[model samples]
Target: MENISFQTAEVGDALQGSNPAHLYPDIFNQGSIHTYDAAMDQAKQMVLKFLNSQKKPFSGITPNKLAEQFKKIDFDNPLKEYEALFKEVDELYVQHATAFHLPQYIAHLNCPIVIPALAAEVLVSAINSSQDTYDQSAGGTLMERQLINWTAKQIGFSEEADGVFTGGGSQSNLMGLLLARDHFALHKYGHNIKYDGNPLVAHRFRVFVSDKAHFSNQKNASLLGLGEQGVIKVATDERFRMSVDALKDAIQAELELGNIPIAIVATAGTTDFGNIDPIENIAEIAERFGLWLHIDAAYGCGLLLTDKHKHLLNGLERAHSVTIDYHKSFFQPISSSAFIVRHKSLLEIIKHHADYLNPEEQDYEEYPAQINKSITQSTRRFDALKLWFTLRLMGRHKLGGYMDAIIETSKQTAGLIDSDPDFELLGDSDISILVFRYAPTHFSHDTLCDLNQYIKKQLFHAGEVLVASTKVNGKFYLKFTIFNPLTTMNDIRFMLNAIKTYGAGYLQ
Candidate 1:
């Protein structure tokens, strides 16, 4: 690699700097306090502009057009002027960025962030604390631990429960499976899967999950070296919840085949349908079969705080491990998630005695390192701060109210879809997500599918609204993942009207 050094003195002098100054007033080049202040001011102005600017959920720019616009910028050269660079960024990225705050954006799990969480982002970014170890993030670690304990209590976990902030639900699920894998290995064959690699009994190890569960289970199995086939897809009920009877049958079949059932992953909120599995029933099955129960509650974990819908997570407390994504349902930003374990000692599976990072001697200390419990990422972000700031500033009920509002909106959306002759509602939503497809009278299944797909593409290209598409029993369906509390019934009506309008055009 070739490196080029710029003469800071000459550059600063040329930029009209008599006192100590930075050659370039950027975040990375914090040579002077004034430079940092100036950069922050510029950032504030840019954020204000981006927020205030009234743009659609999307920009309606095609990939080729975006590519052409981006091609104008030369990465090798530097735009030293902060204003000019921000302007370029605004034009190239911000203008085209998906607006999750928009009520019309009913695409995925992305939610409009709360203001307090956004404020916390400023502090989190400035401090850049790594929550891997105590030495690196003392206050950050404590804050994370406090938040973890708070969440555990909310989920009705015992005092033996503990957790670590993770990147997101996927990593959390991975950690849950990793812990289950190790524990199963040790219990079954007295082997350590982590150090000894895959145990001799690993071939027979099987994990059961709902057919509608997040795809992360298969990915986690593959990442853990148990090929994707290690995951057994249990059948779901009519409402798309994991069927306990089907799970029992699957377990019996696995046992009949001489396979070792390791874990049963019950979902609190499935990705597409937003259906919650029967956790209590599944927990009973897990206990009877001696299987590790893991609940992937990434989307519906917010119900823990909801006054009305908290009962939806009836048996979440019984899970050995749980994945919670604050970003998805708690209205926090990305990367705010955690993997909680009921028994804190089970987390010791990921522990490593790195003399430089987290020495084994620190185990005797009152507060052990956070990295010891985390299964992924040695250098982790202080994501817990986002949730802490949210709780402190907004309080618990207000946050729960936001979830209540969205859930109500989802019900209203489902009603609209059900009443409309042009659409067909798929199933009941346990959370704030509705899956339905545009269906016109006397239309063939193939034609309806094509029309629905076309409507989605046209709306996406026109930047009017953004919704998601999925398949249910070989048929296409449009999904509305309503997480924005600001979304009203009128917004739902408008989205449906647009879908109908586009569907008519496609049929014509």
Candidate 2:
């Protein structure tokens, strides 16, 4: 909290001089081009300095203290100089920022971005291209399309496949569900959901997913006018993968209750446990029932690049749609993800055209506008550039190698935890996340829960190591999302020791 300090100026002291445009950094100004150059140099140096100086994952600043510091700043007063602005930003953000790139920060699905992606980010921000239409971003549109096609091919889709880059997995999942709902409605009831808004049979629409599937499925269901009840949770096996028999039973149960099973969502990698549902078996059931099958491979999509582990995602090609988050495993920055469909025609449900942008009457084959296949997002960022840069610079095999290392390390960590007498391993994951907690032999269930939670908080406050927390069967447990290839057995051991220390201290 002490790192951030600001001086407040009265409202009258604001706006130093006339022509504020010159005061601020602008890239377009011919005369002030020198200023832009100097600013870029300073920005690059600041980033390098922070990257070099980061010693720990977090700064351990309490929320109350940081909130008080934030109260000192007034938005009306602006720092005109780059140096001052950079200094303030460093104090307020950089120092306290979570260094996810660190091996000690094995808490989330946040993968350390590749250098090429960072370079792409710089170009993305500076160019500020919108990927909605060709006029706005011609090369970007083509690049994005190429990336989508490449991803579809990776998932074993035919040349008829297509997709769009989205903010993240949630948006991709929503797109999948929306397409499924509309497609089902049109085929069964002869109703256009886009024109009529959730057919009369919408209440009967049920989506089947493993109990371990992402929570966004339920939320996306609600957004599609199908309540959370619309999502039927099929039971998982001992490995936490969706049970094929359980899935059939749940679908049959839904049908018995007069509910329509429109789609089945199989998770490629669940957040807490990294468990992947049996996609091949699930796809078989979906096909049997004529239901749309969506593979939520937001976390597990990285396997597509890894020849060693890609067999784990056997039936992805059979899915009607799939979500891929390149940021999670491909080592790209945040918000680099796509929603790909087997057939491009399925995306027509959400298609809308404005004469000013994508004209409805125009020959789309001649002029391909991205908005014709997207929903809600009219002005989209050129996130595909980051993945393009990653693929082109690092190559798929090198990136996939990282995934292999992460999985191996994760398995080793799980074994280490399972072998240890002081800990309890709850569930396993197909990728790299481990769910476990600090527990001594004699500790009661409720007592162990409290102890693990306190350990999580203590670890956070210590700021030496960072880990995630989740609950299983209403009992608290610590989670290790070891997606970073840099994380090793030594780092895992250090984090485990920290947890033990915290647990022992709490009991004492």
Candidate 3:
């Protein structure tokens, strides 16, 4: 071999130089310790600056204008400098991003992420653990399992309970329904739908959900090869909760029609009203009919940690499976959610025996792999770390306090809307979400609906505030989802005033 300088190295030398032991001092090179530290420090400062500069919930930029600005960017060539790239990101992206931390951004289920969860995100990305198997993630798998057990205990499940982290409440709901479908098949007809395709009688399989339940139930039924018709929309009470009497009637009608009832999905926190169904009464109905009960507690799972409102989820323990979204009320980042089952053995329905991943018979006994239970994704992110870190640093009580504060804020907001002559409170809130409309004395139903819709559009375009809109009984309503613990009465008053101002202008 010929002696070659680094600048004019041969193929062999270049290959060796590409190794981790020999690399350039840049952020892209893992071997460069100095680059990593400097890059992280710069990123931290940029985040802090952005946070400090965001005084409003949004940038007020119109969609067309933002799209035109983004189209000007050239991706054909690299900027070659972190500073230049970061500057572009700040000006074009971060500046226009919605600020969920702001008190005025009460649009959806989004929450301000906790500091500990942010810290855990840094570590999680650095390690890049795919928590699907034990070999790929030794401690990560165990940590996730332990967290699932803890959550199960919090929900009053027995020691036989088990669960796995999912992408979100939607996926969790899918998994819950999937298990229900398979278990019903096995129990009723001694058939394994997972191995065999959809049974011939699958069309007769019915799943009951409240009319106000999340739309995922119908979607899940469709995805499970049970057509949309498989989902029977049971009537809801005045509070937007599933009516146990209506449920009994629906089940009886299904039985009369020679239909098989697979499961009954009870909503712990409905999307628009935040109303919780009568779980105790629903559980009784499920047991009497021998139907699987699945509770979608995505928004109300925070009550599990609250001392005062935990009773709201009184019959949650009787559920066959449950879906909980920590990101909604637990203050964790997006995608921190889990689908838990009352019986660990029920998870075997989705288990697979891949030799390379989780062998059916291991050489030695150890913790089971997560892939054995997860039905949605194979390459999963370590989302459990976010909740784990949050619990470790903030404790359950502090997290519950955040939930309590937001719930109280909803109550106060309802009171304010009722007291204000310009606004009409639609119904009471069971959680942090309240649905009401802008109703003036002179406006008709159609005019009030249009006014409320116009107000939401104006505020969104102006970017001063962000609220959601929904319709109840063919009338438009402005929704206030108060999940920010920092949101005070003053903030609520300001939001209300802005809505009034916009409504008045639209009318004029």
Model 2 gets an lDDT of 0.89
Per-residue lDDT over 346-412 for candidate 3, one digit per residue giving the tens place of the 0 to 100 score: 9988987878778878742475689988886888889899999999988999998988898898898
C-alpha lDDT values of all predictions: 0.88, 0.89, 0.89
Question: Against the hidden reference, what TM-scores do the models get?
Answer: 0.94, 0.94, 0.95
Q: How many backbone clashes does every candidate have?
A: 0, 0, 0
Q: Alpha carbon lDDT of residue 406, candidate 1? A: 88
Q: Which ten residues in a row have the lowest lDDT in candidate 2?
A: 10-19
Flag regions of model 3 displaced more than 4 Å. 1-30, 363-365
Candidate 1: worst 10 consecutive residues by lDDT?
20-29
Candidate 3 TM-score to native: 0.95
State in Å the error of residue 362, model 1. 2.2
Cα deviation of 254 in candidate 2 (Å)?
1.1
How far in Å is the alpha carbon of 297 misplaced in model 3?
A: 0.6
Per-prediction CA RMSD (Å): 5.7, 8.5, 4.3
Output the better candidate (1/3) by lDDT.
Answer: 3
